[model samples]
Target chain A: MNTFLQLLNRVNSRVLFFGLLFVSLFLIVRNNEAQGKIFLNSAGRVTGFFGSGATAIGSYFNLRRENEKLQHEISVLRGQLAKDQYNTQVNIDTLQRVLDSTRIQIYKYIEATVVNNSVDKPKNYLTLNRGRHHGVKENMGVITADGVLGVVRYVSKYYCIVMSVLHTDSRVSAQIRGVDKGFYGSLVWRGKDPRFMQLIDIPKHNKISSKEDVVETTGFSTYYPPGVTIGKVFYHSIPPGSSNHLIQVKLNTNMANVRYAQIVVNVHADEINQLEARAKDEQ
Target chain B: MNSSSTLRISLKFIIIWILQIIVLKQVQFLPLGPYYYEAFVYPLFILLLPFGMHVNRLMLIAFFSGLLIDASYNTLGVHTASAVVLAFARPYILALVLPRGIDEAFTPSLGRLKFLPFLRYVIYAFLVYLPFYYTMVFFSHVFIVEIIVKSLLSFIVSVFFTLILAGILNGLD
Candidate 1:
């Protein structure tokens, strides 16, 4: 037992190092596939607690600009509401009221404050203050006033991590604005240039107008609503032997400075997904 | 260690941790172009721990502190692994730098090691820390060039900031 103790004592640090290293490696491997696990992701209580304190201090400096932006957003929303309002003329003493409850609401927005964000990495993520407790779920879309931000990839009680559009694997179905039934494509980030993204798979045969063409989400997927502006087309070129136009788009929302977002909750997502699954099984 | 000394060490950890997550993490030197990297002074917590502490205890301390930083950075195990490696390598590096063998109670600091030895110690520690960090971040041999290039760029800036921070917290000695 004394000799065994000597051996154990001799390699105690190495044993501990390898043991801890193994645990860390396990965390890295497990976390790579699913970022939603509460303990490993930033949405956990401990990380969120620290992130909130830091974000609070940082946001204090930008209050004026944030307020102005919110005010602008409110005005835009008000204009949209006015346009949708139906004006009815009353000829007699009968009162007319229009209840829009017949129109099923397909989308709901939950406002969230960004607790932590990073744009420099290959796979960037943003943490928001709202999470599972706030009706947030994995795969829901996140959007800013001007454009779409990302999809919620992980969630905990009071915080969640969004896989930002800046990530390499991020792909958003997008099309040119003002073009009904136009050819759509996928928007992808090339791991650089936070201000820009590449929209690919647009057929070369289609004519793209040069007048500051805007790109918007196609809403083909459950991730975003139809007609959400993504960016403006900056440049496009057709490579030799390729049948698609490589379009560069300048993003409207700056990924680095965005502090607030609204999570898009699709109420009919389950029905759509089930229908699609049945169709796939039939095929 | 006495209570006063323990309090001082705790204070150092708080200052360094805040400097790392709150200040340095947010300072993205965008002018550096694609080789973007954030400065890290939190490793100073492990480096500044009282000497003569067992390697087992030192590694454990480094592990926990790294987890704390990783929580804020959202990299999780990446920082923890790197910090542990640095902690394991630190004693050997210390022995190499100070060939004559030093006192057990002395904590490494700008004042304790003087200027030159202290600088060498910090450089060696970061050299181990940053490359391992970038490797874990990229996580594939396919990014070997990127790992090297990023490590070199980050090393220059991180070491500079760490020295400046060490100078400010010079009272630790």
Candidate 2:
């Protein structure tokens, strides 16, 4: 009788466990775009409040390094600004119309403080203090001063979630640092490492890349401006029965330490996407 | 139900919660390499609940505690699911580890269950919890490599820390 009781007890607990697990999975799956926004935003608000407090304390310890990073960025921007001013002085009359059409506010950056961030998950995300109220929108590209960060996934009144580049589903168009820019590939995280990601589907005929080869974001995507540093080629190998070289890359941004970032706003994205949608419809 | 037991459990929860978020959250598994796994001692709260606590009530508490932890960790539903599963597995794990006719009123701790049995219980409970948490986080079998590597590292580290915590709780008693 006792053995029978134990068996029934085991079966009862097993059923309870699975029933709850089913509900959890149901929550994950059903919490899609519209419904997920409500839950995520409400949760984000509470978390954001706490996270910001912790970040403020954390930021106090990091102020010196933060200042140095900003200073270095400012110096680089100063040099580029100087070159742009000189070029305009020399060629303004002839190139003014073209420059105004192509270069006038195509991409804008909205600065945001990282309230909360995680890198150790298969699907990592970051929560920023700036949100819809700050003109932050979903699908915008997030980048540090140094390297590619992620794309904005969801937005609330005063907060947003950026799906980090380390996410398994995150694929960014990236290219090797060379003249042959046409041979770019989609970079993806394999869920094992935050420090490394893989750029797959490079045709076998391309020369085996050296470890020194740098990788950067390509102009193929509306999310990021061209030439953002993504990572450097850490290693490469061709798996048997496949025609592409599996390129392992060492990510440039130390994701664990990123406390601030800029969101890329592509003014032309809607126009380009609408044009592409029309083409698809016609086909 | 009694004031002292209630106080002891509340104390356990507070100490474990702080140790988890403030201390262990900073403890990375491989500080230099891929940096995947994290040490989780918070689940020890669910593991060491009062032995007489009803399983349903335990699951409810586990779920809310997990939700609170998730609020801090930034991963919603994942830890909650793992904690509920841990709470469910606790009785079975206790049955497997404890000597027969042990008092139900007693909480399972290092002193009560003996060090080796309690260690085995932690291992067994983690075996249930980590796989569920990682699977839910990844949401795919393609990440088997990560799931295994992370689970193993988390189990080893969490068990070590939780055992120390269990010892401390026992000392308090």
- Compare the candidates by DockQ and give the number of the best one: 1
Scoring model 2 with DockQ, what do you get? 0.11
DockQ of each: 0.18, 0.11
> Can you tell me which runs of candidate 2 are displaced by over 4 Å?
A1-19, A27-283, B31-35
The total of clashing pairs for model 1 equals 0
Where is the poorest 10-residue window by lDDT in model 1 chain A? Answer: A87-96
Model 1 lDDT vs. the true structure?
A: 0.83
lDDT of 2 by residue, A222-275 (tens): 899999988889999999999998999999899998988988878788998899
RMSD of 2: 31.0
Residues B58-160, candidate 2: write the lDDT tens digits: 7767878887787778776778888988898888888888888988888888898887888889899889888878877766666788888788877888888
Q: Candidate 1 residues B1-173, lDDT tens each? A: 57787798889989998899889988987545667777788887888888776676677778888888888888788888888888889889888676376788878788878889888988899899998988788776667888888888888888899999999899656
Residue B99, model 2: Cα distance from true site in angstroms: 1.1
TM-score of each: 0.43, 0.41
